[model samples]
Target: MIRLLRLLFWILIGRPLVLIVLGLNVRNLKNLPLQGPAIVVANHNSHLDTFVLMTLFPLSRLHRLRPVAAADYFLKNRVLAWFTLNIVNMIPLDRTKVGKRGEDPLENCGKALAAGEILLVYPEGTRGATDSLAKFKGGVARLKEQFPEMPVVPVYMQGLSRALPKGEIALVPVVVDVFIGEPVAWAGNRQAFTQALQDSVTALAAAAPHPTWK
Candidate 1:
């Protein structure tokens, strides 16, 4: 029942909002993973980033596409918690209790990957300035360390910040460009792997066509 509801929501609402109302110029769709135990990493800007990335895959595979989200923000309210957990199918990572005794922040993520689920991660940890790339956290690298063979795909999105800026509620119509780069491999060390992933995303961003907003 939950799966049906999720499919309906994305097919009826989420996809239309992202692919039509907002508009998406997706490049290199072939780079996306058709199966999982995979990680799709992108720069964080706005909340719409998750929805946009989810739309890249076929609705049938929506069940396997899990976005790694913060527990505090998404699960703060009961209504939102239920919706995100069930409808959006998010894997919540507790950012506040990272280093506490016996707390595994990436535990849920690990389980998801072990189950061959595709994880949509924002390596920036949190959203930053509009169209600006921030320093990536080491969480993704840690995940890669655990699953050395898993493919880490780098993606860059443009114009999402302008479409729905940080503090604004109403979404302005903006054409978003999505650039998917080749899969990044583990570089033997977490720091080097994280840096390589960041570099791949930066290069994709640099290749995106600049859009003029009136």
Candidate 2:
């Protein structure tokens, strides 16, 4: 089955390769809530961020975690689409209509969370500066508002962008650190919640081990 291959690839190859080869380190993993519906929000830097988080999760419950990805980008080709859906267990959002009511991007994600699936969403919408956080979008806020009961845990990582910065095929060995923070409390309005979420991620980034390169 594809699920078995995914598990094998990550457990046998992906996790070890990243953790050992790239020197990826994760912290505050104990902060992740067990036996509950929650979304993990992180800053998007490079592709490795997803793998680092994916490998760090409890393998037994990895099936319950879904990463919110860009439909337009990842699904652009047949092979990539198949890999993302089958192997990566990603839920795609049509970024073209992200905030549009006619095409609510999180429609599928909301349904997934309703079934108690864990989510990994990048609030910045897309990758940004490696050294600083970018402006976050309101999709995360809207989703939280719809599913107010589900907690959104803030996450931050460092050194991935330098390792595999956008467009470079060559991957440099870089020291990476992932910091998971406490769940964010909604601030009533969407705008307030958005700001609070970004702030939470920034706070967590303070703990990243500074990379010598980039």
Top-lDDT structure, candidate number? 1
Off by over 4 Å in 2: 99-101, 211-214
Best by TM-score: 1
Worst 10 residues of 2 by lDDT: 205-214
> For residue 213, what is the lDDT in candidate 1?
16
Query: Candidate 1: where is the Cα deviation over 4 Å?
Result: 211-214
TM-score for each predicted model, relative to the true structure: 0.96, 0.93
**List of clashing residue pairs for candidate 2:** none
Q: Which residue pairs collide, candidate 1?
A: none
lDDT of 1 by residue, 1-115 (tens): 9999999999999999998899999999999997989999998888999999999999878999999999999999999999999999999989877888988899999999999
For model 2, residues 65-178, the per-residue Cα lDDT tens digits are: 799989999999999999888888999988888556778777889898888888888888787877677889888888888889888899888888888997777889987888
lDDT (CA) per prediction: 0.90, 0.83
